[model samples]
Target: MTLQPTLPARVEKDRTTPPRSGPSRRRDSRYEALTGYLFVAPAVVLFLVMGLYTVGYGFTLSFAKWNGFAPNWEWVGLDNYKDLLWRDPVYAPRVRHAAANTIWVMVAAPVLTVVVSFPLAVLLNQVKRFQGVLRSVYFLPYVTSGVAVFFAWQYILQPDGAINSLLSGLGLGSLQQPQGWLGNPSTAMPTMIMITVWGHVPVAMLLYLTGLQGIDRSILEASELDGAGWWRTNMSVVWPLVRPITAIVLLLNLREALQGFQTFLVMTNGGPGDHTNVLGLEAYRLAFLKNLSPTLGLASALGWLLFAAALVLALINLRALRSKT
Candidate 1:
C-alpha cells in the first residue's frame, strides 16, 4: 500500500477560510466604533442641547435676576438663593408650605401605590383569563392625558360630585357634608394624595407584574415543594429576587411625586390657602403668575432645589433598597 502524504490542517482550512490579519481586525474594530458613534450621536446631541444646556442655563439664571422679558439680567450673586432660603417674607412662607406639601405627597403616594398595586399585580399574574383587559384597564390612566385625568378627578371630587354622592347614598352623609374635597383647605392635600395614589398605582402594578414574570420558576417550585404558602414564598423567595424592581419602582414613584405639578394645577391651583401648593407649582407661580414682575431667578432656584431634593432622595432609596447579596 502506498502511504499518502498528510496534508497540513492550516492549508486545508485556508482553502475554505479567509484569514483575519491584524490590519483587518483593526479596520473591523474601527468600523464598529464608527457605527456605535453614529447610533448614539443624536441622543448625545439632544442631551447636550436640550438637557445639559437647559439645566446649565437655568442654574445660571438662578444666580441672576430676570423678569422673563428683560433685555438684560442683573447679576445678584447668591441673592436669589438668599431670598429663597432666608430673606423674602412673602415668598418664604410659600416656599416652606409648598415644600411641606411636596414632601407629604412624595412620602405617602409611593408607599400607598406600592401597597395597593403589588397585590393587584400578583393577582393579575395568577389569572389565566382576561389579564390583558384588566391590565389595560388599570394602566389606562397612566397613558391618558394628564390634563384630562386631572380634570376628571376634579369633577369626581367636587362636593356634589360622584364620590360624595356615593358616600351620601351609602349613609355616610356626615363625611360628605362638611368638606368640598378639592375646595377645602383641610382636605385638599389629602385628596390630592389620594388622586396621586390612584394615578400612580397602575404604573407600579405593571412594573411588579413584569418583575413577577421574570422570577425563576424553579425557585418558585422549590419553595412550593418545601410547603411554602403563597405569602411565605413571596416574602422569602420572590421579594429578595425582585428587590431591584422594587427599588426602581420606589425611585420612579418618588421622583414623579416630588416633581408633580399638573394635578395640583388643574384640581386646586394651590388653592383654598396654598394648602395644596407643591414645589413644582410654587416654582411656576413664582415664574409666570406674579403680576408685578416674574421672579424667574427665584423660579430657577426652586427648580434646582427640587432637583437637589430628588437626587438626595434617590440616593437614599438606592442605599436602602440595595440587595445585600
Candidate 2:
C-alpha cells in the first residue's frame, strides 16, 4: 500500500469523536414528550372529573341520608346497608326477589344467546355473497335504540301479537291462546329472557364471526385433509382457538344481564308483581320512583352492593373460563 496517506491529526481526532446530540436534539425530544402529554391530557382530565369523582361521591353518599333535593346530608353510617341487606321488610323482599330474577336472567340469557349465535355465525362465515348485507341485518338490533327494540319486542310478545298469530297459523293453537306474556307474573320473566337472548345474539354472533375470520385457513384445510369432518374440526380445532372470544362474550353478556333495567322499565315495569324486577330496577325504584320512603342512601348502598356482586362475578367468570383454556 502506497504508504497510507498520513492522516491529518485534526481529521483523525474528528473521526474518533462521537457525534453529540447537543441541546437542539434534547430540546426536540422534550418537545415530543410535551406534545404526547398534551394529547393525553384531555382524556386524563375527563376520567378524573367524570369517572373517579362520580364514583367517589357515590361511595360517600351511600353512607349518608339525603333526598337528592336536600341541602344537607345526614350520616347514617351502615344503617342504609343494613336495612337493604336484612332489617327493612319492604326493601329486603324487593331486593331478594330482584336479585333472584337477575340471577335467572344472567344464567339463561348468555347460554341461550351463545347457543343460537354460534351456529348463525358459522353459517354467515360460510356465505361468500352478500355477506355484508346479511351481517348488517343481523347487527341492526345491536345498533338500534334499546328502548325502541324493547318496545318492538313488547308488541311481538303480547297475547294477540305476531308471535301468537304465527303460532296459531302454524297450528299450535293451544300455545297461541291468550297468555298475557308481559302481564302475567308466571310468564313475564321468561318472555323477558327470550327477548334478551334475541337482542344479545347478534352481538355474540359478530364477535364469533371476527374470531372465525382469524382462524388459520391452513389448519382447517389440514383437518379436512386428515379426514376430519366439519363438526369434528370445529369442535376440536376451531373451538379451542376461539375460547378467548367466548370468555369475552360471556363476560359481556353477564354484565348486561346483571345491570339490565331499561327493558324491564319499558316492557313490564317489573311487573304484574315483582316478576321481572332486577337489582338495577330495584335501585332505581328506591332512588327515584318510590312514592313512600324514597331513600337515596339505601339506593346508593344497594347500587354499591350490586357493583360488588358484578365485580366478583366477573372475576369468577374470567377465572373459570380462562382456566379451562
Candidate 3:
C-alpha cells in the first residue's frame, strides 16, 4: 500500500467510543506502541546493521576500482555503472540477453502453471477419497530436491535416455546427437520453463483451491440451482472473488520465474550461445566469475539494478490489478 504524506492511523477502533476516555486512550496507545518497538529492538538493530553495511558498502564500492580480492581500491565514481549501463561491450550484451530470456520465461511459465493447475485444483477439491494422496502426487515434484530432479531430468533428456528411448520405440528417430533437452539453445529455455511449470504447479493449485473453498457454500449451491455450469461458475464467481489471490500468485510467480537459476545452472550453464542467460546469471558472473578485482562495485551496482527492476515491476502489477478492481 502506498503511504500518504501523513501517517495513517496505525489502528482503527471504535470511533463511537465515548469522548470522555479519548485522551486517556491515546496516551495508553502511545505507550503500547513504544513498548512494542522496544520488544523488537534487537531484531531491528541487527537488521539495520547488516542491511546498511551490505547496501552502503556496495554502493561505495561501485564508485571504485578493484578486483574480488583485497579492498585496496581507488574511487572511480559511476564509471562501472556507466560501463554496464551504456558502454561496456560484454556487460551490455549480457544484460540484454539476460533480460530477454527472463522476460520470455517469466511471461510464459506462470501463465502456463496457473492454466494447468486450475482444473487439477478444482478436480481435487471435488474428490472425497484419497484426496491427500492425490494432492501429494501432484505436489511431489515441488518437494523433491533440485539436485535429484536435475540428475533425473538429465538422464530423461539425454539422447539415449528414457525419453528418446521411448520415442525410438515409437519409430521416432533418436533426438539429434550430442545434447538432448539442454543441447539446443532454442529448446533449452523452453524446456526449463516446462520443467519449472511442472514443479511449480502446486503453488497455483493451492491458491486456486483456497479461492474455490473460500466461496460461500450457499452461494455455490445457489449458482448450481440456477444451472450455472462448472466453467460458468468458475469464470463468473470464483475468479472475481479470487482477484487478490491471482495478483498474489502472479507477483510470486513473476519473481520466481525471473529469478529461476538452479535449472539453468545444472542443465544449461548459460550455454548454447548464451541463450539462457538472465539477470540472476548476470549477478553471478559479475560477482564470482569475471571479477576484474575488488568486484564489490560491480556487484553492488548489479544488485541495486535488480532491486529497482523488481520494485518497479511489482508496483506496476499492483497498480494494474487495482485499476481492474
RMSD of every candidate to native, in Å, equals 4.1, 4.1, 12.6
lDDT of 3 by residue, 113-210 (tens): 87888878888889999988988888788888988998899789876788777777788675543467678776788888888788789878888887
Off by over 4 Å in 3: 1-39, 174-178, 291-295
CA lDDT of each prediction against the hidden true structure: 0.87, 0.88, 0.80
The sequence of per-residue lDDT tens digits that candidate 1 reaches over residues 194-242 is: 9888888888899899999988899999999999999999889887787
Lowest summed lDDT over 10 consecutive residues: which window, candidate 3?
Answer: 172-181
For TM-score, the strongest prediction is 2
Total clashes in model 3, counting residue pairs 3 or more apart in sequence or in different chains: 8
Q: Give one digit per residue, the lDDT tens place, for model 2 in 1-325.
A: 5787886666434546566579977998899999999999999999999999999999999999888876889999998898888898978878988989999999999989888988899899999999999999999988999888888888888888998889889998777637567876777888899888888999899999999999989999999999999899888998888888888888888999988688888998888778899999989988898654538889899999989988998899878986886
Runs with alpha carbons beyond 4 Å of true place in candidate 1: 1-46, 292-294, 321-323
Work out the TM-score per prediction.
0.86, 0.88, 0.82
Could you give the candidate ranking by lDDT, starting with the highest? 2, 1, 3
